[model samples]
Target: MTDESLVRACQTGDREAFSALYDRYIKKIYTYVYYKTHHKETAEDLTAKTFIKALEHIDSCDPDQRFGAWLYRIARNTVIDHYRTARPALEIDDAWDIPDTSDIARDADARQRLAAVRAEVQALPSVQRDILMLRLWEGLSYQEIAQIVQKSEGHCKVIFSRAIRQLRAANALAAFLIILYATHSI
Candidate 1:
């Protein structure tokens, strides 16, 4: 069933619908949280909290609206709340695990480049950085990002482009690394 249909069923008190929604979004939400927290445990905790909040407030969801965006907005807010309560050090884990057959030299190079890009991305304004992460890391479209960020689609696109240009200007290597990282070809 479509998300809208599932949401409508959830509103009518169908637990299965909510389960389905959770199943569909769990990995994506976890990844989003993981990227922000950069710690497996915190990401898992925040992701659970996000889902709990979503379930508690499911009645607020409009079936006509995109459920994915609504879920993401919840996750974004949850992360904001977490930061407000506790400013913990971020652990920058390797973005991807290397396969056994991968070259050790290439893997080392990729990790160094990814570290540089991560630093550059963190320096961007929150909105722009979020736009970049949502667009690239999550592979979300501008429309979805706009809804999650409560901005216009065009504005999100412009912000993403500007952020990319800024990154390119600051460190050309960082910009290239981000693209490769996004495509998982690093």
Candidate 2:
């Protein structure tokens, strides 16, 4: 069923509809939270909290609105609240789980490059970083990102472009790594 129909059913007290919506968005919400938190447990907790908040406020949801964007907005807010309440303890190991490769030297080199790129990306302002991740990693459109970030689509594009430019100006290699990673060629 369409999200609108599912939301309508959920508003009418259809538990199954809510379940369906949960199933549809669970992975996406979890991934988005995980990207922000970097800790599996924290991501899981925050993702659950986001869903809970959505469920509680589902009645207030406009069926005519885009559900995915609304869900992302809740997730973004939940992460913001998490940060506001406490600084998250991030472990390097938790941030990435690269598989073992046959060429140890090549693997080490790639990991080092990836680390540089990650650091550069992390240096970006939260808004720009979030916009970049949503645009590249999540493959979300500028329109969807604008709704989630509560900014104009043109503003999001400018932010994303400026983020890339900053990365390139910081390190050409880092920019290349970002491109490789975004295209899943890394």
Query: Against the hidden reference, what TM-scores do the models get?
Result: 0.79, 0.78
Instruction: Please list the C-alpha lDDT of all candidates, in the order they appear.
Output: 0.79, 0.79
Native-structure RMSD, model 1: 7.9
Write the residue-wise lDDT of candidate 2 on 79-165 in tens digits.
777765553453122233222332212233435555646667666777888898889999999999998888999999999999988
Off by over 4 Å in 2: 87-114, 172-186
TM-score of model 2 relative to the true fold? Answer: 0.78
For model 1, residues 42-158, the per-residue Cα lDDT tens digits are 678889999999999999999999999999888878877776554345322222222224342223443455674666676677788778888988888888899999999999989
lDDT of 1: 0.79
Give the lDDT of residue 131 in candidate 1: 86
